[model samples]
Target chain A: MSMEGSIGQDGGSENWGPQVTRKSLMRGGLAALLVAPWTASTLGAGGGRESGGQDAEASGRTRGAGVTDDEIVLGVSAAFSGPSRGLGAELYRGATAYFNHVNANGGIEGRRITLKLYDDGYQPDPCVQNTMRLMLEDKVFLLFGYVGTPTVTRVLPILKKFQNEDIFLFFPFTGAQPQREPPYGDFAFNLRASYNQETAGLVDNLIRIGKRRIAVFYQIDAYGRSGWAGVRAALQKHGEKLAGEATYSRGEKFTGSMRKQVEILQGVSPDAVICIGAYAACAGFARDAVDLGLDVPIANLSFVGSENLLKLLTEGREDAGKYTRQLINSQVVPSYEDTSIPAVREYRELMARHDPQVPEELTREEYTPFAHSFGSLEGFLNARLLAEILRRLGPNPDRAGLEEAVFSVRDFDLGISEKVSFGPDRRQGLQSVYHTVVEEGRFVPLDDWGARFA
Target chain B: MSSASSGVRIRRLFQKTRFGIFAVFGLIVLSTSILCIYTVDTELTAEYEINIQNIAKTIADSSVGILLNRDLATLQSLVDQFLDVQGIEYIYITSESGEFLAHTFVPGIPEEILASDHGSTEPVERSLPGMGDFIEVGSPILAGVAGTAHVGMDLDVVALKIQRAIGQQVYLISVILVLGVLASIWFVNLAAKPLAELLAYAVELARDGEREDLADREILSRDDEAGHLARLFLHVARQGAGRGPAPGVGGRE
Candidate 1:
């Protein structure tokens, strides 16, 4: 088993082409001595990859944790279970679809993007814990694609705590103000319109339709409070106040009854009701509202996951049309059916071709993901924008230079009518809030508010 | 007298008014104090259990929908809110399939709890290794379809409270017993003082063979049985040998 015996045995049997002489052995030793350090340095520089080399540009610049010579890893914590599972699952599916496409087509400067995902089930504590693990344990290059406002609001403080590490979250899927306002705003980059914009648009459009008496139904959490504040501010502009308000605890299910909330809103006799909640609870409220014979225009925000809300409302009911009628939703992303836009067409093709599944560990519930949705489209846009920023960072990206690169993106087009922009003062990339209504089991753009409601 | 009669005499001594009152009152107060302690212990234990059961039921009801969806994070959050209630030590939720979905246990669940059967619907007394005794109550969520939520109420907390109550009761009993003994002694001395003076005067009268009025004015002026008895004794002693009535022999009558 000794090296000399094995060599002698092999040499005695084969009598190989090259004969070993003292001068030849001395020359070989000298050559190996000269090459060993170079080989070691080359392997170390290539991030211990089996591929002996990396990009010439990557070799010349500094890198950060989770950014290897050939890979860039991003961490994500989203609701992969619970009632809002579809939102998280589909969003993840959409982003990974784009990342998969990018990885297939030579990646970003030959460094493939890998998303390290954990399921927080849309709870703040778990999301915070997952964020800590992502930064401390996993050492992800950046936090990306966090879902839900409550989860993101809780994680903002954590980003502040580790500011010395240059840790930043990129394009978390929330429109809450915590990451867009002062104190924590600098730590996060947002791609979605804030809840203020969404609610203001809903309130203004509802008022324009002569529905002056508006009641609000919201989840009793940070997400709900943010949307409520938006509605309050918009109402104050017209010297009006909310007609009435009702709230439901977060993580409520579609199977749960919402008759109490329906009665509360109905008691106020509002002409329209705007709901700030997730899909399951919002769908339940809408269902119960129709059942209770209180017919009014009910609006939901983009975070409500309109596709999932519609599915939950219509899946088992024979009179599904009644539940969806007079329902309006505010979305940050454009409609996926609108192939007129270049990004929409690309998103559709890539989504179909890739068809990514939710990670196996995160899928505890039996949820059928959407083929295409506003949530998924938003996720795709987020991934695409992040890819653009990463590309702008050139081959060697550092955490320290992320803010500069993001701020450099001024009025960049993502193939949509609305141009994406970021600045030193502005943390949100998108400011447009699009309105939609359920039509023929799909959400289409709402063009004329007066015709629809009046 | 035979030993049995002698024993009866000794019992009669204790059956006397002063001795009997002290013995009876003490027995009554001591027994009453003990009964009160027993009642309080029973009531507090029952109340604590009922409080724990009500809390467990509430938690189980709220956990039903979350458990049905298999949302562990929400369930964990739900159970965490109940930890601030007094006597609540820990809470752990099990899935319908008998897997632990959420637990408030730090470090880890004890081997005793992990090894024990969690199928009991009633409260089970558990003794954890490092965590002390607990009254583990389980409420079935969705009638056991969504699994069961188990709440551990610390028995050590209840025991400590009961011990404090007993200490207070002992202090009260001691004060009552001491007060009862002092009151009994003073009452006996009050009643026996006059009788003792009358007995001594009678002994001196018999030994000196002199007819003298009772010197104790208080006893003589009592105007009741003792005064009447004193006047009659003086009258009888002065007229024993003379045929004529010695009316002045009974002085100050």
Candidate 2:
């Protein structure tokens, strides 16, 4: 068929013509001019991009750069679209809500805080991309509430390049040791407990309980290596070595890995097993141990938080209950289930006001208050500490002034945890651990063993 | 007899004039009407998709906070609140193990929908206020605790919003189409007046056999296909009236 004929047959040609008159064309052109602006205005109204009637001063309070009149911009990068997207989103929500509350209450010292968030997708490449964008494009004054171990590691070089630039990388979600170390590290602060501290705390309680033979299951990454080193160092005090050790890849299905680890553990017949991965793997290991008839008590670091583990164990409730009766866990942060603590009360209240849909009851079945979220409270504490330091800088804090202010932080106490002390040698404040055992499917504290490892 | 012939010729001329005017007006009106309808439909569809996406992002962010806080009650309450949101049809919160934690609708979601590994199982994405398919946000609880908190939102409300937007555009386009048709008809009639006058002059020349005076004149000056057709018609009339053949007559035939 001819091109025009085919086009006409297709019904599109009906929309065009050679018979159009000059007069009608003029009318159509005028109509287009009149319609174009009206359509654009309607679209702008419907799309919600036009911030009509919103106070510019209030909006400016969010986008302001570098300690402006009534606002401070903070940068954040987290995995908002990958496997860790859930955790990243949660952390962002918690931090954002808290900031919103603070902003609503006239902000910190007359300056409202705004968070510039970028999604890293839980990968190193995206982490670097997002970090650079936030630092260069957004020109945020400081970085805060970043999550993930590899992502933090990937961004270290870029962060170092910006070291002399006077930007602070504060309260990254990961507790990796290098983030707290020198040369490659300095200026970066962590709110979570170091793996060494967590593992040492786990070993300390194990030694006290008279469980000598222990096997460690780790994820073979920076997170795992740090915990393993701490475990070995803590065991060395008693002149002992791990009974057996196994490592697995992150995000691997735990069924086969758990079976293989159980077999290896069976050879050593350790009195206890320490898992240093996520709760899903821990649950898999617990289930496999039961199937293998290895009724040894299982212990895990803070990474295997209670909420996720409980949910996983609840899947095979009857069998899991029998095997996990003596399951124990070490925590670096206060338990959300512990209502008596001031931090827990504040956390509950904050959740209520900012996110009314979240449950008020802090139960083991519903909530997992691990070092990450708990550590975020540490971020809250750090933000407060930084605000104080900014105030002490007396109006305009330079890089050197902020540095001196941080070093002078001594015995600053927040209600949830113990006193935080920072000096020349000690940058990480409040090194403490809480020991708990599962009783009726919940972690119950065994002793007042806070800061025993420290 | 000549008077009767004149009456018959007038009747024929009137019929031809009416038919020609109507055909030209119809073509112009139909073309303008069709163009307006097509453009408006395309624009409205694009707007609907954008609205759905924005709403989805907002709902996803809010649900993430609930999971992180480990507030199951709050998570449940949020699911309920989502149902009331302008474009949401259904919302569900589930564990990683495929257990329903909370939902806005009472009818239980199929286990397959919760556990299906199909990538398309993710709800159809739309860009409407409070409209989107299901989005799952899983937060790991306590250090050893392994479970996912999943939130699912239905996009029916978003679909409805899209329909409403399209409907509004359709109405507006219909109004424009009607006005465009009327304007096109008026314009075609005005343009056809000169052509009708030319046809009358040709008829007068044919009757009086005054071919000598028409030798230097042509119907249309521009060298276009339409001009060519007008020239052909005038040449044919002159030749058919027993006038000498035109210079391009052999080639044209």
What tens-digit string does per-residue lDDT give for candidate 1 at A354-388? Answer: 78777454566798888899988988999899999
* All candidates: TM-score of chain A: 0.86, 0.75
- Candidate 2 residue runs with Cα over 4 Å from true position: A1-67, A81-86, A253-257, A315-320, A356-400, A448-454, B1-253
**lDDT of candidate 2 at residue A242, scale 0 to 100:** 81
Q: Which residue pairs clash within candidate 1? A: none
What's the true lDDT of residue A51 in model 2? 26
lDDT of each: 0.75, 0.54
lDDT of 1 by residue, B73-119 (tens): 34555676688698899987776777666666643457687786765
Give the poorly placed runs of model 1, Cα more than 4 Å off: A1-63, B1-253
RMSD of each: 20.8, 21.8
User: What fraction of native interface contacts does model 2 preserve?
Assistant: 0.00
